[model samples]
Target: MKNARTFTTFALIALASTATALPFDAIDATQAYQNEVAILEATGAMPSTEPVAIFPAMPEEEVAAPVIASLQDVSLPAQPRVGAPAAVGVATQGREVAAPSADIALPAVDLAALAETHDALAVRKGEDGEADAMMMLSDVLFSFGDDRLEPAAVALLEDLAPELEGATALQIAGHTDAIGDEASNQELGLRRANAVRDWLIANSALSADVVTATGIGEVDPVADNLRADGSDNPEGRALNRRVEFLLPDAG
Candidate 1:
């Protein structure tokens, strides 16, 4: 019995020596535990090995992290829509100007020579083109209401012949008093103007093409043909019966 105890003690010492010489990585954990349990059972030990707590390994840290830039550091170009105004930082030279209209016509002006040469003649300005002249007729120039010219009419036209020698345009306009019917007076006035225009072209140096005749009857009157009481005004009637001439611009 004492020899048996000695043999067990020798066996434990040999196993301990073998375990200490071997590497932990070379040994299987399950097989080593089973061996320990067998040894303990065979030796009849009072207690077994206790359980050990195991935990997972910690995650590795990143080597280097990426960097992000701020919004103010980035820049972009501007884009303008079609038909819109120019973008900022752009410069414009000038705006376009419109030309004058072609449809408008300029006014006519008379020659300076015509104005200076005919200063002795009476000149009247009218709204329509050119200048005008009026001549008052006498009772003796024509038999009352008749278109026939008397000896006095011929003498008066002869006196006016020198002043109208080189006139480019001459229009003879006749007027009458309100004593006669409108149609009869219009016809008489026209006939009287025609006689005078024809006489001037034939007897004087004036051209036939430049002279024309027209009659207004009593339509345009310078004086009152009748008094306020509807009575006859002889002087006004006499003033109404007259002839006028118009001379247009030479240039």
Candidate 2:
């Protein structure tokens, strides 16, 4: 029994040595794993201990205040209001502007009203009591630069023949504008006056002795021959070229 116990003790010591050698090999493997971890950390291949955020924080935006304007800083001209009277020499942008005249004088006689009274005939009182009734004849009744009367004139005179029933005497005066020489104008006026007188004696109840024809020429003009700018006034000249009939009061 002693010999058997000695063999068992020798076997236990050998097994203990084998187990201690295995622990040493395991320690070497642990040191190799630690070295690999140190190399990866130095090369920046290993992840950090703290967790990283996926999104970054944003900065706040600053807001500016709005600016306001005042009406007193603006400059403008003062204008006339609605339905206000117009002022003369109004100041505008350091300049003077003249306003139109409002109080314009109108003509004393309304020719339109007279035309409507009788077949375009304008009748008025004779000046200085030369005659009781004075009738004006438009120059349009005669041709231009001629003493011959137009058909329209004949028709007008036919209508007027009946109105001169109780007249004792009839006087026809012809006037011309300042278009020709004084001698030519005088002759033309006399011829025009004679034409009217002859027509009245032939077509009406008036005798030749009772009718007298005269030529006043351009000396007695009823309108201005020239305008304010020295230009020929066609309208005024047309008004002056006319014939007038003077009749005494029917007694």
Candidate 3:
């Protein structure tokens, strides 16, 4: 399944893989933020290949400002819009991203196994070759911005039993729409993802040690913000607001 949403606007759509037909932003601001350190190093603001101790730390925040400002002169789209939905999903094109290719990797798993054995999940191969999958959590799954899973989500958990029981470990990623302060949205997304994890362990056989959850709010979007009204879209933002599942590194 293909999961993508437009948080700047509430919309959703379901597809099997990254399609040439997708209508999304040419550049995602989330990637820009992730690569900021590289940008800073390239410009000589920070030392070569030396990571800062505190990200967005008080003093770092002041230093990051000028580095971010430098991008304005370039043609790339790095403008991050705030004050949208707090939790959103992820989007992937037809091709999978290899797990070892970068800092964050989502692997590609067997699509049939994921669709039938697990929850409604969209699978992908990371650039680094990690097995990555994503599942779209509807507003009905949990109250808007709340992490607790709903009765409907519980039903889905029952279906997920077999897959979780067999996996070595699992990774759960939480995302949000571009509807609030970035810092707060990140925290909110984490809460929601954790809430879902709590539900699975309480009601199912999965162990806590086998799972890890991440929260990324309003960062990676499959739907462009321009036509978020669904006026010209099918699944606008709902698709973007979701949780991703990935295979863990045994290495």
Candidate 4:
């Protein structure tokens, strides 16, 4: 009886010690990234406390809290894999972007209701006089000088998730400023669009059929021919660098 009890106690102690938490700062970056990605996929947050390696095991509150704080300032998307140069930046397709047919019956996403009071949107009203809501990717979906989604982008997505969920289809378009050559612009634009498309397919809880990506390269312009401040050379050119989110249009 005495021997059995001692053995049981020893086994329990060993088991408890084995399942210790991870150390935050002690973890190397490479390991930390692996740990964070796994945790984000699992717990939905980064920076965990597990020894040696961190298994995807975090509480719901633990995950949701950080997200709230992290997404407060950042208005763009998460930096996982969205746009950028294909070789170095986010994963992108080559030149020649592919757009969905105008006749495709895609799902509808209410861009206005979704962006209600949300400053992270830039909806271009109807070309004609009408109340229209469209998805605006003005510095909200990608990073500056890079095409990848920002780090806090996921949390931002989480905030806008409902809007995204409401949409049945998503049209990802890539645009570029007129500074670069036409060919480079075209290639860069395609890469950016494809990158976003890939990200939506991987992370978004939407169907691929309901989503398509295209790159316009310097064709579309939203703002005046120049920038907001006083700059003659920056008007339409700067305005050209933008992406648009179109709701389901039968036409």
Best TM-score among the predictions, by candidate number: 2
lDDT of 2 by residue, 64-170 (tens): 57856568866556686688765657779989887786655423323223344565465444475423334455465798888898898888778766565344677
What lDDT would candidate 4 get against the real structure?
0.58
State the lDDT of candidate 3 residue by residue for 53-142, as single tens digits: 222222324333445646556654234349532332233675544333223333423433665544545555457875456565546467
lDDT per residue as tens, model 1, 38-139: 766576652454312111122456556666666776545457668665344433465433334443443332333333433222334456744555454636
Of the pair 2 and 4, which is ahead by TM-score? 2
- The full ranking of all candidates by lDDT, starting with the best, is 2, 1, 4, 3
Model 4 spans with C-alpha error above 4 angstroms? 1-108, 131-138, 225-239
Q: Supply the global lDDT for candidate 3.
A: 0.57
Instruction: Give the TM-score of each candidate.
Output: 0.47, 0.49, 0.47, 0.47
| Cα lDDT listed for each candidate | 0.64, 0.67, 0.57, 0.58
Task: Write down the TM-score for model 4.
Answer: 0.47
Task: Point out where model 2 deviates above 4 Å.
Answer: 1-116, 124-133, 248-251
Which has the better lDDT: candidate 2, or candidate 4? 2
Q: How far off is residue 102 in model 2, in Å? A: 61
Alpha-carbon deviation at 152 in model 2, angstroms: 0.4
